[model samples]
Target: MVRAAGKHTSARLVLICVGLLGIALIADFLWASSSSSRFALIGANWAPPVSLLTPITIPNKGVDSQKNNTTTGRVLSATFADLPAPELKWEKMAAAPVPRLDGAAMQIKNLLYVFAGYGTIDYVHSHVDIYNFSDNTWGGRFDMPKEMAHSHLGMVTDGRYIYIVNGQYGPQCRGPTSHTFTLDTETKKWQNMPPLPVPRYAPATQLWRGRLHVMGGSKENRHTPAVDHWSLAVKDGKALEKEWRTEVPIPKGGPHRASIVYNDRLYVMGGQEGDFMAKPGSPIFKCSRRNEVVYGDVYMLDDEMKWKVLPPMPKPDSHIEFAWALVDNSVIIVGGTTEKHPITKKMVLVGEMFQFNFDTLNWSVIGKLPFRVKTTLVGFWKGWLYFTSGQRDKGPEDPAPKKVIGELWRTKLNLGS
Candidate 1:
């Protein structure tokens, strides 16, 4: 009888061991499948170090409390705002040659030049797609110089020339590169410029007072914010200085922020403090979301080279470093990533068209977009506000988007009521 009891116990132990082994095998298979699928999509040989389903580790603090307190209390919304219709509609135009995020766009007369961006999961694009506004068609495509970084680039144009600054090179959150280049729109030629002393990811770059000023972007680690402000003397698409000169650092340092020169004053607005970081010991630089603090804080570099706090945006916005247009006396911003939802804690994307009136020193929600999207390239031409190429959400409520689109949409700029 004792022997029989012992045999039953042995059988139970064997079954439990087999069950545990089965569970382990399933987990391993799922991880491998996830890694292989990403590799297959990007046609890369390296394996992913982190699973895409890994939960992001956010701090206990709420996102609404993330704004810079120094600048939050000074500004108020305009009492008599010029608001567009809630159901404002847009008309679709030509589709982009490549749908992308993290790309840059510049309108040179009748032509819109779109730069390199992330085309697919882990795939970085290195081509320029040109859209002609004269005939409303995609005119041509051209390859970027091989030295150019594929994504997270800082691009700005001076009428006939487009200048690209330091950005993330290659794919999968790779290290930032110091390479800089300029493209002549008239000749369609590329020229290498003096590299940045410190490469930064998505720095706010603009031409101000005959110098290319670059400020506030993530450091080489892909997460640390950089406050190192530098400028190089440039004239007529040529670098006049051999090295960048140090300038006054921004009060808030981060990337994916908008910087523009209005009335000869530099305004930097709407950026986040934290960004994705690569896992330690990752061979392929597998990326994961870090604890981020998005802000609507706006800072201005006055003529005296001093930083001044300005009115913040209507909400904490980011991913809009290049998604802005200077329309008349106001700066118009399209879609971008906003703070996470309060209840669900999921990331939220901005759908409304926002305008910051330089005349009134106020902000107003001017219009609503067709849908919520992020990383869109915007241009204003002939009274039309055009946006193209970005990731789109499933619906108004859904924060996660499964599709990237190249469809161009436009609305009349004068339709504000």
Candidate 2:
């Protein structure tokens, strides 16, 4: 009788275990079939089936299809289209004449004007390198104005004209400058514009509705963040007003933020609140690294000229002011520095490419770069996404900056038809 009772108990335990396993499998099937399963579960640590990661287009009815209505009139949502990964084939292009960081570049006609920037620990470039998209070659470089800032410049282009605003006049944490200049790409000449009332370090600069808007940057001390906003009416590479007029200040102002004007809407995203501080009584403004708060906060200047908050980036990113390119209705941003690692407490260089969909107001990691980098100058030309000239990282797993690179790279953008 005792042996029979033990056998009965063993049989019941086996049945219960099988039942629990069956329930778990059913639950997993249900979860994977759901729409939210397009993205892999957090900490999954395992590869899901390819079909589970395929892109699925869904109709969006709740959002209106109106112009300037925050949706960008996007009728369909391609939320997980880049899931698993997009077809990113980055090809090497002509190398830049010099390596630089904190530089600026703009695409005008068939030429990409790469501006001066920090060359090395002891050097700063004061020249412009032009890349001809037509022939895939670097044209003859030209000298910038003697007064042009070498780094931290806020630049924007209006057709044949390129506008450059205030920045650090020189290297080693030097004082910010108040000078502003505009260049005529056709004539290859630089013209002086009305200087900024208060000099800033890498303020968000953009052109909107016949006015040049400049906002947010580091103060003269090179540590404190500034919230001052100013604008000036300009035309044909010349400022119509002698003085900049005050505008609504950015709610969260800082330097190295990406600024763009899409369909009359102005946006500022990704920057840091603090920067290197100069040591007291230093002649060359020698500085030391300071604690900073890098944020992904995004803001938009609405049609009413009031700032409105928008969906922020997935994580904190900085030094991305010039590392973004507009593709269709999406802004494809390349590499930059992100928050420090939790365990190592070391700054983590961003290797992933981020895409911000204007229509959905959502951010996504579309792909990864060949190597991690920061302050990369990004441009979109003839269906190709081009990025060049920034500080490259040590390796894939290491985020420490290794060296500055001038190798230009481009990949065919196959996001949409």
RMSD (Å) per prediction: 14.6, 11.5
Per-residue lDDT tens digits of candidate 1, residues 243-331? 99999999988899998899989999888888888888888888877887888888888778999987777667888977899988889
TM-score of each: 0.79, 0.79
lDDT of 2 by residue, 1-417 (tens): 999999999999999999999999999989868745534442132222223243334426534223323421111122321123343678999899899988999887778899988898557899999988888899779999888888999999998899999898887788888999999988898889999998899899999999999999999888899999999999999999999999998998789989988877999989989988777888877867788888878899977989998877755788988999888898888888777654455566777677788887767767657777899998888888889999987764356677988999988877653
Query: In candidate 2, which residue pairs clash?
Result: none
Model 2, residue 160: distance off in Å is: 0.7
User: How well does model 1 score by local distance difference test?
Assistant: 0.79
Best candidate, lDDT-wise? 2
Candidate 1 regions exceeding 4 Å error are: 1-85, 415-417
Scored by TM-score, the top model is 2
